[model samples]
Every structure is written in C-alpha cells, then in structure tokens.
Target: MEFAKPLPNYLVTRYHGWKATSYQENKGWYRRLATEGQRPRAMVISCCDSRVHVTSIFGADQGEFFIHRNIANLVPPYQPDGDHHGTSATVEYAVTALQVSHLIVLGHSQCGGVQGCIDMCKGHAPQLEEKTSFVGRWMDILKPKYQLVQDIEDEEQQARQLERQSVVASLENLMTFPFVDEKVRDGSLSLHGLWTDIGEGGLECYDPKLELFTKV
Candidate 1:
C-alpha cells in the first residue's frame, strides 16, 4: 500500500495554527468582523494565487483590509443578470457595505491567466470550446488589455507593460459599479494599481509621471 502523507501538513497546518494564535491574541477582532460592521480603510483586489496573499503582503490584522481574489484578479463590468460574479459581489460589499475609502488592484508578474491571454492574442492558444477550461474563461477578461500592450516594441518591455496595464484594466472595471463611480467622483474613494514582481521581491506602483511601474 502506498501511504499518502497528510494534505494539511505542509501549508494548512501552519496557516491554521496562525489563525488560532491570531484569534487568541486578538479576541474580539473576528467577533466584531463577523457582525457585518466593517470599517476597513482599504479594499484590495488580488489574485487567487496562493503566493499572492493579501493579508501577508500588507501585513494586515484579521479585519484590516477587505479583500477579493479571483483568477488573475480580473474584475468584469457590473451587471445585474445574476451571474457568478464573486468579484463583482465583493466589490459591491466593499464599496457599498463597508464603505472603504481606497481600493487597489494588485497584479503580479508572470500570471498564468494573463500569459494564456497573451498566447491567445498571439494565436498560440485555442479559442473558446466546450473543452475550454476555467482558466480559459477567466483569461478572456484580459483579451483587450493584452492586445493594447502588444502595440509597444521590445519583447521584454511588452510583457512588463501588459502586466501593468492589466492591473489598470481591472481597476477601471471597478468603476463600472455605480457606487464606486459615485464615490470616486466625489473624492471619497481613490483607485490605485499595484504590481508585485515575484522574481524580484519588489512591489511596484503605476507611476503616472513615467507612465510605467516603479518599485516601491
């Protein structure tokens, strides 16, 4: 018999222990948070990648930052047709329920979904089919941004440029929500695009001055 090791030993064990310890340390934090009383200063739209943990990235406590994550962190424009819009629902909760003041879209380098979109734009990836998996559907959000980034020369520069633009695209999509647009226009809300370069351990922000990402 091939004995399989326990699944939680590597990652889940440590994470669960941390959660328990955090609750022990801060007794009322989770309790208060569960009561639907959120006063978070910022809401982070992050990728579903295990490595791109929002709480760890910002060193946040249990209820510090309102977070939403999806494949590639893509946010589709708001619609009311009762779609499987986990991202859109989270945005609505953050903006309308929580009333978060700042919202940041965090995109990371070498995103698999974005890469698939780039490949599709280059005619290397397959089109939508019944066999098209979840990743293919998720990456469809990046089609336009990928094409826009390709207009730039320099292959190395093109990838970096696309990553940053994808972040901006997601941020722009956040405005499709009526509440987000209203708050943004009234100066009560601000949007920022952040890119995390995993290879370099650097967090970069969209620099309006240079029109590129700069390490922060």
Candidate 2:
C-alpha cells in the first residue's frame, strides 16, 4: 500500500525512549513473556477514550490483562450470523482459549461515544443515523439503554447515567455468549462492571444485588 504519511516524530521518539528504558529494564520479563506466551488473568472491555488507561488504573504489568477497546465500551448481543464481529471474537478467544478468570466492562464519565449515542438516539446527530456510519451502527448496541435515562431532566446527569448504563448493558451482553455463559456457570469465570469519573479520578464498581455503582 502507498504511504499517506510517515510516522510522527514524537511517537517515534517515545518508542525509542520505551525501548531504551522499559524494555531494557524488563528484558528478562519481556523475554519470558515472549517465550511462555500470555496467561492474562482478566479481560477488560473499555472505551477507546485516550484518558482511560486500563493498566494505569489497575497498576498492572505487561501481559497481566487482555484489554479490548471500542466506542462506549459497549458489547453487542450475540448474533451467530457469519459476519465481522471484533468484540465478540475477542471475548470468545479470552473465554475459550485464554480462559481468563474475569471479564470487566469499564465505562467512564464524560464519554464522547456515550454522548454520541445519546445525541444519535435523540435525533441530534443525523450523520450517525446514516447507514454508512460505522460508529452509528456500533453504538446501536446501547440505544435501548437510552430509554432508562431519558426521563432524567438534567442533560449532563442523563448522559452520565447512560454512560454507566453502557457498563450494565455490556455485562448483560457478555452473558449472552455461550462460552462466557458456560464458563460462568461452571465457576471458571466471573463478570464485572465498573465506571470511572475522569475529572475526580474516582472509580465505582457495580453491585448486582443493589443494581448500583458504589465508590471503590
């Protein structure tokens, strides 16, 4: 393929720094990981937001978590049709192949994707509603949850509520996968939902019994 542009110099510089410092300092660890392969304990599904760093939040090391990012941190319901499904494929590999013990859906406040979903559902984003809009089609997974927050009179509050709802929706959707369901039933896997406050740096974990998110 023809090149649109060369790699950015800043990113190249950062890569060089990491190669010299992090890679050199952890050469043995990196070598072991490369030789033994990854045995990650958890799979975290989070938004593509640049602010959300899964490893930084958990203080995790390399190969500790199998992370996947997508808009709104939403998981679509299982559809067995033979077609492209990135999130589903990752979940399958994690559950069946990797046998990850925990699967966490991480949502965050001030999520642009969640806001976009709210806008698209409210008829404010015509561009997203178009058939060709991949983001629009992907976000349709969270559209139903919008009804849960529509009655909130405060717009910002409603958007935040919907952001948390994205986590709940994803957790529910995760159970729809047969492999995930089987593993959970067999006591081999667990599911979790979490939401983060970007500005305050607060983390909340969802309690299924109370159907609420409490600070962690």
Candidate 3:
C-alpha cells in the first residue's frame, strides 16, 4: 500500500469515538468476546448498499450475527471448481465452521446492483455486459431473474420485483450446497428471505407457503 493517500480524517475521528464509548460501556463483554471467539446464531447475507444497515435494522449487538455483504446480496450456485469464490466461502464457513442456525438473504429497495442487472439484461448497460467489468460479471448471476419481472409494465415496480427475486435466488442457491441442504433437511439449519423498503423503513419477510413478502 505504498504511495496511497492518508486515511480520511472523519473516519479516524469516528474510530476514536467508537473505541472510547465501546470500551467504557462494555469492556467486559468485549474481553469475553475476544477470549471465547464468536458464536453468532444467525448469518445475514445482504446487499452492499449504504442504506441497508443490517445491525441497525435488527438491533443486533456485537458477536450476535455473522454478516456478509455483496453487490446484490446474491449467493451463486455451489461451484467447487477450486477457484476464487468469496460469497460461497462465507456461506461455507458460516454453516460448517460456525454452525449458525439461521441463514437469511436480505434484499432491499432501490438496489443499484439489482438495477444494474436489469439494465444489463435490457442491453442498456454495455459496460456491465463486458467481460472485463467485475460488477457486470458478478451481476450476471441475477440476469436470469430479470426475465421473471420483465413482463411488469411499471419500471419502478419491475425493479422492485427483481430486488425481491435476488433474495429468492440466493435462497435457492444456498440449497445447492450439500452441507447446507443436509442441515436444512435434518432441521439443524433454516433458510430465510427478506426485503426492506428504504423509503418507508418497512421490513418484509418472504413466506414460502404463499410465495410473497409480507410486512414484519
């Protein structure tokens, strides 16, 4: 990391504030966490959107939830090709190593990644269709989902539908992992899908029985 610019001043200041408050309020808890290691009960897969705050929305404390974030909160199908796979690795560690009981795919409204998938599928984003563009290639996983919503007449509604589909797609992909499938079948693990409305601050959980997202 030579010749890189200095870290931003605001981030440095925020770190100091967090350190002082965290140590002052929960020094014992922090020490215990460091000594015992983490044992989060749930794992949350969410979009890498600034507006989608998993901890804040769930009121979770430190060491409670194992969180993983990607462009659109997608979990690609299990591919043990011995290549680089960040999301898959995270899921493997969470389920096999951590033994987390719940795995949740959390989608959100106004997701730029989802919108990019829509644009790429519609031939509107050429850069994303290029092989060199990492985002475009990563979003390819969600391209098939666009077809499910393409028939929707309203542009906003279509985008929203794709966002929800991202969650469902991730859930389906999670089941492709043999360990995940085994645990889920034996009742040791459960899968969940969720969507959030950024503007309305509303949360919805997907009901597999009805195949719809209802407010939580």
lDDT of 1: 0.81
lDDT of 1 by residue, 9-28 (tens): 76988878877897688767
Q: What is the TM-score of each candidate against the true structure?
A: 0.83, 0.98, 0.97
Backbone-clash count (model 2): 0
* Candidate lDDT values, in order: 0.81, 0.95, 0.95
Candidate 2 collision pairs: none
Off by over 4 Å in 3: none
Across 1-216, the per-residue lDDT of candidate 2 in tens digits comes to 686888899999999999999999999999999999999999999999999998999999999999999999999999989999999999999998999999999999999999999999889999999999999998899999999999998999999999999999999998899989998999999999999998899999999999999999
lDDT (10s digit) by residue, model 3, range 1-216: 788998799999998998899777998998999999999999999999999999999999999999999999999999999999999999999999999999999999999999999999888999888899999999988888888999999999999999999999999999999999999999999999999999999999999999999999
RMSD of each: 3.9, 0.9, 0.9
Q: Which is superior by TM-score, 1 or 3?
A: 3
Error of 1 at 28 (Å): 4.4
Badly placed stretches (over 4 Å) of model 2 are none
